[model samples]
Target: MRNTFDFTPLFRSGIGFDRMLNALEAASRVETVDNWPPYDIAKKGEDDYRITMAVAGFSQDELDITQEHNMLMVSGQKPAEDNAEYLHHGIAERAFRRRFELADHVKVVNASLVNGLLTIDLKREIPEEMKPRRIEIGSVKAKPKAEAKQIEADNQAA
Candidate 1:
């Protein structure tokens, strides 16, 4: 059974979270997503992440990876053979495309294909200005204007 949700109420009350709400709505709306090639997402370190996808029988030339802003797309298409005869076709070589949504400041650093597994490394590089910093607090002493001027005059006279 498929499920659906209405985000109109969330849109009215929520502030500065449009992207997150939209992603949730889109995920809920997707009913038939192809699960041909399995994938896994894991965190390597505090700011490093890795995504591994099973892409058997796919070469580097046949695969395509693209990133636009916070969206990553991976697609593969096997070239058709000129003369091939198969009694029972079992392996799936059809074209497939997959998308991944990335958070802000997360970037794709590297990608590699080995042993039919596609590994993509991601690193989160937050800007210095956006990072949290500590502010030093100090006490201030107030002095009267007339006394300050008198002390300055006395110092000048001496």
Candidate 2:
């Protein structure tokens, strides 16, 4: 059974949420998702993240990583073998394309393939203007009672 959700009301009432709604709609589509290459996402530091994928049969030449806007795509295609006689083929060599949605300001820093694991490092590079800054609340200075009385008396005498 497939679950379906309606975002028409949200679209009608909300503004500047099209991207979020589109992402949600895309996620709702089950056929577009593939689980061939298992992956793990881990947070290494405050703003650093790592995505590790198990690409057992894929080489560096066969894997392609691309980032467009806030979407990260990873795909692998094995070269066709002409003269391969296999009695029993168990390993999956099929082509696959996996996509990951990145948060705002998240960027792909580096990617490395080692020991059948493809690790992608990501860092959130929030602009200085966008980062939260401590705003110094200015203290309102008040005149002393004696000074205020003297000023008032002087104004009256003048």
Q: In candidate 1, which residue pairs clash? A: none
lDDT of candidate 2 over 1-158, digit per residue (tens): 88989999999999999889988998898765578899999999999999999999899999999999999999999998669799999998889999999988999999999999999999999999998999999998886666444333444653
Runs in model 2 deviating more than 4 A are: 134-158
- The whole-model C-alpha lDDT of candidate 1 against the native structure comes to 0.92
- Candidate 1 stretches greater than 4 Å from native: 1-3, 138-140, 143-158
| Candidate 2 residue pairs that clash | none
Clash count for each candidate, listed in order shown: 0, 0
lDDT of each: 0.92, 0.92
Q: Per-residue lDDT of 44-72 in model 1, one digit per residue for the tens? A: 99999999999999999999999999999
